[model samples]
Target chain A: EPEVTQTPSHQVTQMGQEVILRCVPISNHLYFYWYRQILGQKVEFLVSFYNNEISEKSEIFDDQFSVERPDGSNFTLKIRSTKLEDSAMYFCASNLRQGGNQPQHFGDGTRLSIL
Target chain B: AQTVTQSQPEMSVQEAETVTLSCTYDTSESDYYLFWYKQPPSRQMILVIRQEAYKQQNATENRFSVNFQKAAKSFSLKISDSQLGDAAMYFCAYRRSAGNTGKLIFGQGTTLQVKP
Candidate 1:
């Protein structure tokens, strides 16, 4: 099975610095999404992208957070002026079709630790 | 707002036995989707099983099965003949069947321990 792959399984960044997390969704998948899971907390949706633009985002996805499909395969999440609260495991996911009926495949996840 | 709840923080079962993890959700929308994801010690999120709200029959994947009660808004996962590999943190998630942007709303998770 084709799986979503994330780069830099672990990332340590200083506060107030910018960090970019990269993901390569399954080659044929159409929709892409980003989710955050703070230790001991439920996973929270960050943003969802489709057709090269953001389709939806959660309140947690503030102005400091942005997502882009730099190319046909790469989907990147960039955080500006990171904070301690930003430390969490970030998961990238993709689905072959629209709607919730289709299962979303997940990546191994990137652990972002902020100092 | 839709919220998924996993009341059991942790559960234990002996190898070769059976165990069930509980999950409930608060949602007014009649149509939606439910899923079970397992995060082992390696911390990789793997899909276990999924059930569609519209389907009257429960979803099953080999040893993994779901008991879905749409009216009660309850979805639980049952592991039959459990094995040591089943030990992990299990999460119950919900997604709306309607919208195009299908972001999953997840539960806090339940840690399952299998003793050999």
Candidate 2:
């Protein structure tokens, strides 16, 4: 089965530095999303992207966070300035449709560690 | 705001027995979708089952089934004849059915341990 793939399984960065998490969603899937899970916390939605634009975002997705589908297959999430609290498992997900009704497939995720 | 709650932090069942994981959600929307996802030790989120809020009948997938009570805002997952492979973290998720961007709100998750 075709699955979502993410790059740099683990990342270690310092506070105030920038980080970019990359994902290549399942081929032929349309909608894409970024979500994070703090240690011992629930998975939180950050933003959703479709048609190369942000369709929706949560409060956690502040100005420091940005998502881009630079090419047909690669979707990326960039945090301009990382904070200690920003360290978490960042997941990339995608679905075939734009609506939330479809089941979203998630990648293994990129673990970000900020010191 | 939409929130999913998994009251049971942990649960265990003997192999070949059955187990049920409880999940409750708070949502104002009339039409939505509910999902159960399982994360094994490998840490891959796999879709176990799904239920559409508008449907009254529960959804079943082999040994896995869901009891979706729309009125009570409850969506519980039942695992029948549980196996050791079923030991994993299960998360309940909710999403609005109408929107183009289907962002899922996930529960804290229930850690299931299947004893052999």
Leading candidate by DockQ: 1
DockQ for each candidate? 0.79, 0.77
Displacement of residue A16 (Cα, Å) in model 1 is 0.5
lDDT of 2 by residue, B1-116 (tens): 88999999999999999999999999899999999999898887999999989889999999999989888999999999999999999999998888537899999999999999
> What TM-score does chain A reach in every model?
0.98, 0.97
Docking class for model 2 is: medium
Per-model TM against the reference = 0.98, 0.97
How much lDDT does each candidate structure score?
0.94, 0.94
Cα lDDT of model 2 by residue, A48-111, tens digit: 9999999999999999999999988999999999999999999999999866457999999999
TM-score of chain B of each: 0.98, 0.98
User: What's model 1's lDDT at A29?
Assistant: 95
DockQ, Cα level, model 2 = 0.77
